[model samples]
Target: MSFGDLLHQAGGMGRFQFIHVTLLAVPILMMASHNLLQNFTAATPEHHCQIHDRDNDTRRLNVTEQPGPTTELLRAFLPLDATQRPANCLRFTAAQWRFLNPNATGANATRADVEPCLDGWSYDRSEFASTIITQWDLVCDFRRFQQMAQSIYMAGVLLGGVVFGGLSDKYGRRAPLIWSYMQMAVAGSCAAFSPNFISYCIFRFLTGMALSGIILNGVCLTVEWIPTNVRTIIGTMNGYCYSVGQLILVGVAYAIRDWRWLQLAVSLPFFIFFLYSWWFAESARWQILTGKPGDAVQELRRVARINGKKEEVDKLTLEMLKCTMQREMASVKSTYSVIDLVRTPTIRRITCCISLVWFSTSFSYYGLAMDLQNFGVNIYLIQVIFGAVDIPAKFISVLVMSYFGRRVTQAGSLILGGLAILANIFVPLELQTLRTSMAVLGKGCLSASFNCTFLYTGELYPTVISKVSDDEQKEKILLQTTDIEKTKPTG
Candidate 1:
């Protein structure tokens, strides 16, 4: 019933406001990794990769053997030519040649190999089921289904980005953002129940519609409320929150192997989040600039109160409002339309370049994460450790992003991520310890890109259109990923 207080992304918010907005970074971090493709498709098994830990700063990694030496045993399960090297790599037995865990042989054996597939002892291992397409055994159509799930949700995100961003300008940031939570609740719950390819996809697409707002609007909402000097600190800490979510996800996955339950665990929280809508207030700066001068004044009063200011509400004047709006408008070159994105050379260049970065970052980032689930590592531990890597990146971001610059900081993150990914191709899999260390590093490296993307996106977009959620488009994306399971497949 009440607009809590007016807030702005870059400047004009007080001390208390800064902390509140900083918390929004958590969700932005979560959404970046919460996709079905990421949670389900990107998961790895406890067996696949050889755990070569190049433990120290040295090149030599300690080697360890285990019962499920999947990297050594599951090579033939995949179609990778590199994995099938005659001399070097650990090789997998064919499905027909699968044997039981050799560790059960005796008490004296320190390390024994465990073979997963037993013809007579078949079990429902979803991660293994996915290998049908990954290994080329299932044909192109099944693979297409996987890709389609990824693509559709992303497309919905694209639409939501524009629509929700614009809506922030046209109506207000809070309304659409809060509304998105409602959609997320419904879409996510439904997505959990999706059975067939079509039905699963539909629910995921709807989830995307809700997702569309989470990043753009949530961050925008926080930016509106926090102070500038500490913004990056709060923002990066938000990145840390996502890793926490990842850890949370591991617990959820352990309890509920089914895709539906996983979706609910993540989605249902938003339903609780929706209640905060009543506690939120429209951005006073937005209100004032968009011609709602009286309401803006009221909001500014509330903020002044929260920050412990002694100033009376009646003391707020049109002069202060004018000064704030003037500051915001100074940066605007001209109003941009969707058409202007292509029509204007600079806007087009920036848009297209960022878009490519977005697409590439998303594809590779999600791709690698999904790919890891198939890598034969301990899924729970891998997920937890993977989430753990973000800690350093978040710390590094806080230190360098402000001192250097967003462009430089972001470009470096991308470069590092790309190099790490490419480096994975050359590492010998028989050197299990080294391989795991490298893979973990690669995951950590790529996560930096995600952090940079959200931070960069905030700096680039104009305030008004930045937080709108494109409902229809976002929904489309959510549907595609509904059928995905957290257990990734290995060939």
Candidate 2:
């Protein structure tokens, strides 16, 4: 009998499968939190150069005791940019008290000599009580550091996919996934308590690496254990969990305005995930293919017992597992590598197309998702809208794909998303509602594109090349680095 028959004999999709899938899917909810954590954790608040101590005293007094005259007093100490807001990087060399006169126009204020913020900056803390930006003073000249931190984190993610993908194939999914849980918990917590920007980035990099490992191995474990008929449904459900997580981040970030506390809140749950992860059985298919039929038999029997098929599984043995998976093991003996992806013309073309799709989808997806502050709305409200759109978008995508097919679904979503993004360029900036709507539309379509890409890419690759190709596919996440510079907000 084939392995599928063996799985049926062991009570496929029974109680054990339910629990296994539930536990595995729970961790996925937080994956979105980590992926989009920077949106809240690094939010730049309104800031301006610090005024001299004497002028600062006057400003403070004006804020607390006398309000009207302090408006003009601020003009004496700070220069207004084109937007007529205080310039973020410059301060008057000495207070131009003349500008405090009510008749002094903005033109007269512009003539005052200014210098770089030599002392420091003062941030408006109405929205965020704390963030990496405020904590580290990553404003003006240091603003690029914010994007640099995210790039480093994405680099770690790229490396983790390469490292853990092969390691899971060699070692086993459960082990790497278990280790990844602990790593995420530890690294993310460490990032929360990081004493400096460099340390925070380092910890976040490790957290990103662990995130990749968790995702890669978690999917492998879930797919390998479950019956094939239900795989698509289960996969879609897991994707939904990530969408739910985006909404969860909005609530948590709103409640805890401090970045460190927010980071800790999202991270500590992984520790619970790590603790229970030890209960998971390794993939029986992996065990059999790797020449451990004895262990595979044991695991299958354990699953059978849990699924209430003890009588049927009592007859199971190592010989039966080896006999059933003999062909699969034989196939495993032949190795594949990156070179094989392009060794043939057809495969080469497929690889290139899949890579491009992955790159573009991720590029546009993160570019919009990461720049929530630029949307010119309440960040919490915009985040909620962004998260909410994904639910409908993914649901529609699944229906379209089921009815129309993968190619049509994938291509249509990308085209629609691109048109949405392009349409924004011609719209007037003053039309805030229209701009926000268009952005949300583009983001949702891109999210749908991402959903289609995953299933489509998996179907396109042959089994022999699939594993290697999946790893290579993840490597293309390096394309995310290019977006760091592209998405930076302009003055």
The TM-score leader among the candidates is 2
Q: Local distance difference test, per candidate?
A: 0.55, 0.83
lDDT of 1 by residue, 327-441 (tens): 4443243343566445545445756877777777777766766655455576667777777887886677656676887788778877887777788688776765666676677
Candidate 1 least-lDDT 10 residues: 482-491
Backbone-clash count (model 2): 0
Q: lDDT by residue for model 2 over 136-204, one digit each (tens)?
A: 899999999999999999888888888888788789889999999999999999999999999999999
Model 1 vs. true fold: TM: 0.68
Error of 2 at 71 (Å): 4.4
Candidate 1: stretches off by over 4 Å: 1-19, 22-33, 36-38, 41-122, 125-144, 323-334, 339-349, 402-404, 456-491
**Model 2, residue 5: what's the lDDT?**
68
